[model samples]
Target: MAEKGKLHIVMFPWLAFGHMIPYLELAKLIAQKGHKISLVSTPRNIDRLPKLPPNLTPSIDFVKLPLPHVGNLPENAEATIDVPFDKVKYLKIAYDGLKEPITHFLKTSSPDWVFYDFVPFWLGSIAAELNISRAFFSIFTAPILSFFGPVPVLKGTQEDRTKLEDFTVRPKWVPFETTVVFRLFEIKRVFNSFTGDDDDVPDTYRAGAGIEDCEVLVVRGCSEFEPEWLKLLEEIHGKPVIPVGQLPTTVFDGGDDDTDDAWRGMKEWLDKQVKGSVVYVAFGSEAKPSQAELTEIALGLELSGLPFFWVLRKQRGSADTELIDLPEGFEERTKDRGWVCTSWAPQLKILSHDSVGGFLTHSGWSSVVEAIQFERALILLTFLADQGLNARVLEEKKMAYSIPRNETDGSFTRNTVAESLSLVMVGEEGKVYREKVKEMRELFVGRDRQDGYVDNLLGYLRSHRRLKLEDQSNGGQRN
Candidate 1:
């Protein structure tokens, strides 16, 4: 039996690092309150996770369940970082195979609540069978979730969105004036992902079922950022919509040592630059820009002529670790003012540096949180998923400036990229965005406010916990 007033919670995020890292953050937050946490993932993914704090080791446990073999999924490709973007469908196949083991685990351990991501659509039903409370924890922002609306709307029966044009406009359910809709090119990819027929388990069904089955809806943002959106989510879902805060990584949190040779060299280079003069470029772990787009970005960086440090990644859908080729002679011309790192660099340490002023990013929520935490200027260049929506929302908020691109084909020239980079980094036109983000930073970095959200969430969990018949003898009932 669980200790009095203590909860044993199970966290099961998707295989992607973006999802896993946030789940781990929540786990740590709960564990700090003397709750027991079991974070389940594949063996390899568990190995790649950042080490838990020494104090958390006792309360938080890593539960490994080996991924089942599936054709086309590369050997040992347990996480999205391991395989290319296109092969993630195969990874999903392997992920669904975990149902048996997870079900068995739940049957044995009987955690009070299970926090899960959208990928495991069926887990909710299993949790229901065991009378375990479950929450669909979304890493996406409130704006994106509000745009997608409720399960019935996403499931597409009444007033379903059929054509690509249907998604270009603001969703009717929003009930407020907002420009949080996807762009032409972005909607095409998002629409297909939501309604694709090639896979056995459609993402639309996963998202709808995940939402429908969960007892509550939890988002990764705060009411301060988008109060209206959070209210709209509660309206549409007809349940409590909780914002668990942005879950930003603390700057003082110890990570890789700066004395390491690679970090030392980068630190020295950054030290030489003027304060707030450098643009930090990274597209995060998942969103890989294509070769053509990368070439334009390279030439654009050269044209911008600003001091930069780009943490580049492999090409989209590539299985190899080798960095993709840049435009010929591109690196040589910019070598004096720019550094491109294909290998891992300490992102938080670099972002916190004095020389770093602006971030040219793919608009991932995690990346956005990091940028907002430091009050860095944002130059948005989105490639996939909810990133475009994020870019649109940030632009609407005047918190970031996006690169100019052809609306239909999502094509951008090197000149536009260069212009955007210059404008957001050093141009006078960027003052509004710079000021707005600085204002926003107060909320993002407020550790007290962040912790309060977690505390409130824990309180809700404690009050609402439905004890099984066996557990009733030990604690009676939560209420």
Candidate 2:
């Protein structure tokens, strides 16, 4: 322990950028309170993270551990971004291989607490062996956590059996009225891709073990946004569940620099558009759509006739390289009304612009928080994990609209995309969603309230430090 009540904490997030970024944000927050934080990840991921704020350099350390070689996992493919969706399980296998190195680090460092993500279900037992208190810092929202229920449900021991039908409807635990279940297509995709093969560990088991092993469950949401769900989480888990605010990202805080010529051009275009008239479309760093899906999205934007700024993900060479090309003459037809950027366009700056009226997104929790902080309504078309759960929650709250899709096959047409875009962008029905987001913006952007959540988290960590068996008998805390 450091002098004057400061803590030495470890932060370990999953390999995905979505999970790593939030864990980084939380590390900074805790460091700001005069604690020392050691954030652990692979070498490439640490290098890819935004440069640390100057003042934070002394208080925070980035500990890089090399991922062990695993058969079939590409060389240097340390993160999910480095590989395709199908190959992610190999990344997990590689991630788990870090047990030996992480054990050496933790045993030497002997930190006060280790906060980790839902992946690495094995971490809890390791922390236990070392007698270091551990926390499961969830980057997901409360509704989804509640939907997955306590450890029993996540481990497939509940009455629901964790079957396909079980996911298509809201679980019985949520007494409040909500339509927060997966669609047929969504659940099938999850079952196929996320649930691993016989040799691979399933994601559900990971989440369960992470929750079961944690001293406290920390969520990336606030009580103001989902009080009932937060409350339900505590009851179901029979443990302390904390909400550390939304942790909203600011313009150019810790991402790629945004002052390039490309951003300047996009800014100029945004300046010329009418206020609240443009739809900013992005599906985050992950969630690559198929060629058919991408073509439909292009035609849908064209048919909607609304001004759009799309940040399309560049396709990798081996993954459908041939079909990756855009529809012929697409740029020629939509040149006047749309601009598609293949490179990174600072998302915070774009969403903060006056012209960006709505976000057409995959409903990733971080993206949704960023958009709401700027009062931009959502137009959801979820394609990957937990996004459908977020879309359903927002849809139930009447604060967003989802593009219609076939229930069984989960296929959506251009017409449905156009219609959903129109409804959320400029149609009469979109007014409710627009106003609702504006009203909820305070919950996301209120810095003071957010700071309070972090302070409370620190207080809990301090009070509940891993006490030695002798100290516990005398009610003494370790630090």
Candidate 3:
């Protein structure tokens, strides 16, 4: 290596909090191993760094890049969570412009390795050209990686399988009893439209889209969660599928005094509640429900009569006016039993708390992982992306239950919402799910005497580096 000083690493993540958060944790872990890390993102996001943990701030260097202006994008829309969906075009253009600066930075800095997310498909070839080893860091689980990677489908070779009636047709290569929905084809088409060229889609996207390729896959897994999927991924990839597990306490590190106070107050309120008695509801940053849906949800929560905490975003779009009304005196009616918080909350801390019996989530992979990590029983109400698939997997595994949606549009009705809330929060079914959740929590969180996921990850990283060094030295001798 470089005179036994420190290994330099560069990390580039897609401009989204869900993607950036995990990569940030990995970077911190690398830094702790005596490596220098440079994390590159837009200037707007870079400005938010001061609000993060001191350890994350000290261990990593931040590179602020300008967001190239494209038509229709707002001036201040650079932060991962702030960017709207329609401005994805501008983001692609901005990212494309970044390639040159990234190349120059690599040439000057000469990092030993580059860790990148799926959005920058071209980075692999660039890293190879610059003689830097590259690793793909997937924030998803192993089954997700395996499902989206170059695995053969049972439905035979076809470009678009939507025309086929039975979407549940398993692939020839997949050993498990699996089924695919026709809607997945529609999702692929949408993603392909945005990326411009089909060739540029990452291997995972391609595999999910029915294209095949040979590439290394990395996932976030541990011995306790989905071990079978991890084993299957290794078998399919024919390469080491490293499971770094969950990195320790980083996401909740930031926030001002006011924010901290709010979190503490919420925690105190939760602590007073009995175990498995509360329902936690949050739709991640990207998901904004319609006014009608939001009203329905509010009414449903009120009808459930369970102790609940709901996080509501302040702004609804121009077309949606439902949240503003709130059924006239609805807030007062539910004041004693329920709480509604505006803006941000410490999500990870809330999820891990004892009183949170069930999570009513949008089923984002990051949220799913967090829920699993905390071993909370779930009431899955998926909205978009692979979230539907995640919900299906959880239901199939009997780990969580899905809220029944409208047959025509797959949207949740108020009745369905109320029913699901009652089933997960206070009904007989809730008790059974709670026991299963407790067992899973014990498995993942581990016992008082044993080391949990974080320790296993640290051990894995050390062994991985040693093996890499051995391989490099052996190859040099051969040369």
Q: Write the per-residue lDDT of candidate 2 for residues 1-479, one digit (tens) a residue.
A: 95757789998999998998888888888888999999999999999886788888999999999999998787788888777777788889999998889989999999988998888898988998788888999999889999988797677566464467778886778898788989988888778544568758888878998899888899999898899999999999999998999988743355456556777899999999999999999998778888888989989999999999999986522332333556899988989889999876789889999999999999999999999999998999888889989999899988889999898877889899999999888889889999999988887878898899999998888777634434867875432
Clashing pairs in 2: none
Deviation in Å, model 3, residue 313 alpha carbon:
2.4
After superposing candidate 1 on the true structure, give the runs of residues whose Cα lies further than 4 Å from its correct spot. 250-259, 316-323, 466-479
Q: How accurate locally, in lDDT, is each candidate?
A: 0.86, 0.86, 0.64
How well does model 3 score by local distance difference test?
0.64
In terms of TM-score, how similar is model 1 to the real structure?
0.95
TM-score of model 2 (CA atoms): 0.95
lDDT of 1 by residue, 181-242 (tens): 88899877666667755665767678888999888888898888899999999999898988
Write the residue-wise lDDT of candidate 3 on 1-479 in tens digits: 36464567788877777777777777776666556789998887777643545655665889887867755555676643555444454565566568788888888888766777766656777876776656666776776665543434312243333332233345444587664232333243334332345223333342333212213444665645677778877886675666776443345443355577788778888888788678899888666666676778888888888788888764432222334445567789988767788767878788888888788898876776667667777887765556666676667667778787654455677888889889877788767665666666544434331234434544544455556667778874110
Deviation from native of the Cα of residue 405 in model 2, angstroms: 1.0
Backbone clashes per model, in order? 0, 0, 3
Error of 1 at 244 (Å): 0.6
Model 1 residue 287 CA deviation (Å) reads 1.1
- Give the per-residue Cα lDDT of candidate 2 at 245: 92
Q: TM-score per candidate, in order?
A: 0.95, 0.95, 0.81
